[model samples]
Target chain A: MTVLARARRVREALLGGRNQTWHATEALRRGLLLGVGLVVAGVLAHNVVLALLGAPLLAASVLALSTKPSGTPKVTVLPVARTGEAGETALATVRVDPGHGAELLAIRLPDKGNPGPGPVHLLPASVAEIACGLYRRAWGEGVDLRLDHLVAGPDALIVHGPMVGREVSRVLLPPVRELPAGPVPARPAGLVGVHRSRRPGDSTDLRTIRPFQPGDRMRRIDWRVSLRSNDSMPYVRENHAESDADVVLVLDTRFDVAAEIADWSLPARGAAVRPGGSLDTAVRAAASLAASYLRQGDRVGLVDLGRPRLYVRPGAGRRQLLRLRNQLVVCARSAGWSSRPVLNAHQVSGGALVVVLSPFLDDAVVGATVQAARRGNLVLAMDVLPAELVAEPEDRWGEPVRQIITLERRVRLDALRGHGIAVLPWSSAEQGLHVLRPGARRSR
Target chain B: MGRVRGRGVPGWRLRAAVGVVGALIVLVLAVQGVTAVLIGLVGFVAVAAVALPGSPAAMLLIGVSAVATAVLPGEPLRWEVLVLIPLVHLLHLSCALAAILPRGGRLHLAALRAPVRRFAFVQAGAFGLAGLVALLPSDRADPVVEVLGLLGAAGLVLLVAALLRDRDRVG
Candidate 1:
């Protein structure tokens, strides 16, 4: 570019167009006025000491003002990962090209309940680049970052923008912990599956000995049974075939009651998942269950009772597990308090094990779980509600309110058990799975 | 672009430097008179103002100190007065550094090089002028002519500043 063109561009950048402009900050204006006033006063009063001190101030202000900052520097923030695993660190870099005359660059990132790296101030330089590191502490889609860039001129006399930049949205996947494989259905479908099927086909386990049919394999015939029969009829041994079962995870997103006593009174948005909140417990448990079932070569699907639109078809394999995890984050993100919770029968496959994860705060969730169980699906209502309750301080009738809610919740859970649907507290997941075991009868 | 971060001078370090300079100024003033010490205390208050990241109170205090020194009864000219001028300039520079830099901001030695260089030039000029003034017979120069000379110098500085301000760019 020609020198004249370069100069023109610099002027335009300093003056700014409609969208961007350079303006003096309060500090800068104060410095300029004070510097001039003191120096002039020193000269008029014939005080050499004062003039000497004031001269530098005046010189600094003039020098800062004279050096017009180079054009409005555009800040470019690199794209961050769309999905992050809990405890994983993700980096986002912001670059300012040809960063001439930028005295200070202030970069602000987003703040959720979890502490994020604070704003960084880069010393003035020709080219500045800042890399922000974010730590994913919890599950669910957290609005991780919104970049705000502010550029100050020399001596910070002139500043342009605290311009709001693009917001970074990150979906933090729930950490899947080690969970023991739960009980599988007695009657499984499909040719290749993990569970044993009652209907004999081709498997290692022996089923029953019967007279050889027309299509019976020759190898399956039991010679001892045939010799004992003495009726000249060969008996064929049948083996139970191993098959896979469908596990449909039903997430109740109506209300996320925090387990912590102190967080009960906080605003719902911030208090939605207080580390060990009911929703957090549900999401984590659901993730663990899905991973365990999928690892067993079983088809797993997901259904959010709060949002019917988000539904995952029954699928198996590693890809399905990833899809289910992503969906879980979406499910938790939209798991706000709802008045009416919906659970459709189409969401559950016949003979499928339906695990309904809910705090059971609302009677509607309890009704949905019972309805699913009654429809011939084995429903396990995982009570994610904390055992103890803490009431808000300002609530005058906190004790009475707690007592009433607790009493109602107990009755609802009893009703669910009365309908043969297994009501289990999520805290004791092993006992719940034991209850669902077909061969191993539960004592309860 | 690659990641880049520069550490400028630390705030506390610069503030401590200014505090030491203030203590020296107080000691000098105490030797002069109790009234001068009181004036030094006032200047210290202004130093407190400059310690804030963005405040102009330092300038007012500097003006007050200059007036106090000029009007005070003393030997018409002294070598100590010349030394005090640059020392006061240094204090102002330190205060400005403390004020302009962000809190906890590390001062890049590179950034300080230019300002410190300019300050050295200004100090050299001031010392040269003081030397010439000291050579003159203290009783020979008329007080009116001395004031006129100071005004002429101030005018010359204003003219230079105006010319510099009009320039399209600062080098």
Candidate 2:
């Protein structure tokens, strides 16, 4: 391409855009055609009233044409909140600058995951700002707004666009419920935390009062206890060492199923996880447990059974909670069936509470849970399967299919219990609470 | 399409409004006893305009209304023909605006102000023309009346030009 040719091409492009930006709409065509045709016909036929009526129609059309838009309007979608929780409404503001001669503006706002550009909002061009509110229906990252806009000249005679604006995406975090799990089990490792460790350390929970030996600091003496004792030795109060435990939440994204048995095999149309589906429940459950453990000063991490690349290393703090929730969206975004579940020994630390969240629909997930249990991790299998199974209305064998699924799931749960893995329903209130009890520490 | 009665859709009610305006034009033509074909075309345009405003049916509907006004045998200055001017414009305005916002978001009243203002201004001007036609002496087809008609038309054109210039000045 020569420079002259390139310049020519560029000129043609600009000219083409200018020409194509404004096209006569149906209303414009109607006005001009009828306005001209009627006035001419009425005049030649000697019918004056007809010509008079045609005058206004002609004037309006001409006015619309005369006010030809000079510049192509620029449309921008500014999402007010780039991150939101499921079931929350997110707002986005759409702005357009039609420059001049544009009368009306139409822009599509967010609809609930509706295909295409969602809904169109027709407003006058003078109203430059448009507010679109979209309700985030489900968890996971999603495109919040696909702003499609059109600018039209007065009386809607000529239109400038159907020009599509870039999609304004948002990360919809999964809703976190208060998962009341058992107490934080004592770990002997960390120097400081909320839970008791086997070794004595600085925590309010007392271990025992013992006689002060040599080299003990004078501040260690409990004078009241020392006076009560007849021995010559000064007594000191010893407290259990407060240590933090590591909690690793394993999420099974192998399959997503809802209570609706018929729709189980159907592909999710545009959703990462079906609302209230097994995978959704599992993600939410994992988030809740993570929040609980983190609040208790324990380190919490995430392991994606289907995709190990999404693994989050155990960490403790407020920042860790946000990291886990954000990572959960990424995990669910790519949730699908993989050959074998990957809950490797290295993914979980020694004595970390391993909570497996899955529907336990297939044997591979069950086998993985059993392997984690055998690897000496404290394992709890959270059954996230929705209990209220809805049968297909029209299928003749719906009841039989439901019964088979229920019985098979029941057998799986029993098998998991047989392997010494505590199987608890996700809806259970007191799950993992026993882990906090004195001497409740158990390893596979 | 007209089936877009979704709750969240903006301009959800505009389609109904456009349909009403289209229907009114059709009714006027029907009462005037114009050709059935023209009336039928107007009727189809009414339905099509609401469902697919971007389609050419709206323009065709305007043309049919104009043709109906031209050929109707009654008084040339009958109020029915005079009314079609604004009705067609309203249908056009409503249809075009409806097509802009087919579906989502809440329609703020501010958004409709400019277009509605324009619609009203154009209609008032059109009705003003109708008033002038009523005041004129008689039989519009007469050559003397033709010259006056031509002069009034020239004045109308001049007025539109002045408005256009005024818009340019404002810009």
Candidate 3:
């Protein structure tokens, strides 16, 4: 289906009919009768006496039956956000306009079949407004509202209401996108380097010497080696080039790592992180880097080392990017930190250029990055910190605690660099991922 | 709180309560002799005047009660008694108008207009004059006056029923 059609469907599903009322008509009748009956009884008992009191009661009855109510009120629904990562609050607004002098006694709004009661207020004749917010806990389609006792779902909105009126507006939120595998990067123009060899080919550089089989090419044989050994021998040769690097982007969704800027001087001292939390920043960074690398034709794959592990096998094309983006959005909603680590030693077997995007506030993730690099992968660690952490006042906490945390961060940074892993620190305000390559001459 | 459903009191109960109350009030007034009987007759005619369908029937009942009160014996006609009769008739008329007129739009507007208000005021003034007339002295000592007083008493009972009936139907 078309994007607009799909988006429209999503809107209908999330913000549909939900405005029913429960009026106590019977109770009112009972109260009226009881009051009248008591007065009549008292008059009969000589408890009270009046010249013509009974006349008003008779008149009231006639008037009550003759009056009838007017038309039902007009309502409008507006979806605030759609396609939010799991755990983020999606806000929707419902506006109603009761005709002149009309009074709405009550209103109800529900979520995906679950009922949510709303506050009712007097609207100026022909104008009323109600707002609703829902916390998306799972990934799926469709959301609906409940009015009075009636279930007003997306189908009702689409069928009953005029599609063009100001009554309703449906919004679809697109999912977050991360990295995916693609082609290798092209060699930079005018830069000369030894070409990497997957199999023996025409190459001047000697890559390695190993025991050869019968299929070994004669051209690759070392004649000088045969003379020294005094026996028939062969060599398998290969060359490494700068363009052959593979980038494996690792996105951390662990709780210990604060993905957002710290509101407090200390990260751990703030309120518990909410659902969307800081993971959105990591997802955005991963997507941008993956796009850049894919443009250069470098093989790119994404490893989501969060609670629910997500792996996108190395591939190329616009379709792959879209698929990866969809997955990222779903992951943002569902993934969380767990007791067990998301990545283990066996997952990084085939060496590739690894890019780990995380805040590095957690010890577990820092260890995981170091382990991946030790396995001979070209690992680039992109550390995402909230902008507030850099500007927080030092007096907010004891000087000793601040010194200790900073010292620990420094130690961790040095340890990663010592093990030859590139570490780039990033904040929300930063324009792009900061490059943390080894030497000054080889800056990213 | 428990749910509210249906109309107020059960229909049968409401009808019974109004009927019983009307019967008892009329019975009590009848036992108070000629003056009480005259007042009771006035109450009954007032109720019937408002509740009954025909305005002419109510006007006839009012005339009969007026003549009976004039000729009645047992207690002489007081100034208050004279003033009360017209006042009661006017009240009955007002109730009848309330029943016949529609409650909304132009009818509602007319009900609140100056002419209607003036009419209501005139009826109240007539009733006050009758009450003043009841305070005046009168010399009437015949059995016809007694019989008239008895008929007025009966009319009073019917009027009470009419008033109750009107209330029940409208409510």
In DockQ terms, which candidate is top?
2
TM-score of chain B of 1: 0.71
Candidate 2 residue-pair clash tally: 7
Ranking by TM-score: 2, 1, 3
What is candidate 1's CAPRI-style docking category based on DockQ? incorrect
Ranking by DockQ: 2, 1, 3
Candidate 2, residue A319: how far the Cα is off, in Å: 1.2
Taking the tens digit of each residue's C-alpha lDDT, what string does model 2 give over B1-171?
011123333466777788888888889888888778867767877888878877877777777677667766777667887677778777767776666665434454555666677667877887777777678776436678678867765665565455433332112
lDDT of 3 by residue, A413-434 (tens): 7888898776765442233332
Window of ten residues with lowest summed lDDT in model 2 chain A? A435-444
Model 2: clashing residue pairs? A119-B103, A119-B104, A120-B101, A120-B103, A182-A432, A182-A433, B9-B104
Query: A-chain TM-score per prediction?
Result: 0.86, 0.85, 0.51
Per residue, candidate 2 scores C-alpha lDDT tens digits across A1-444 of 999667755764766543346665556656665566567656666675566656666777776666667676787766467887878776666666766877666667666656434766666577565565677777787777776777777777667767776777778777778765443433534677776687877788788999998877788789999998887668998877778888889999888999999999898776777878898889888888888888878899999999999999999998999899999989888888575789888998877778889999888889988888787777778899997899998999998999998999999999999998777787663544554333255420
- Regions of model 1 farther than 4 Å from truth: A1-32, A62-68, A72-74, A77-79, A92-98, A109-114, A122-132, A143-147, A158-160, A260-265, A268-272, A392-396, A438-444, B1-171
Instruction: Judge candidate 2 at residue A392 and give its lDDT.
Output: 90
**Model 3, position A8: C-alpha lDDT score:** 48
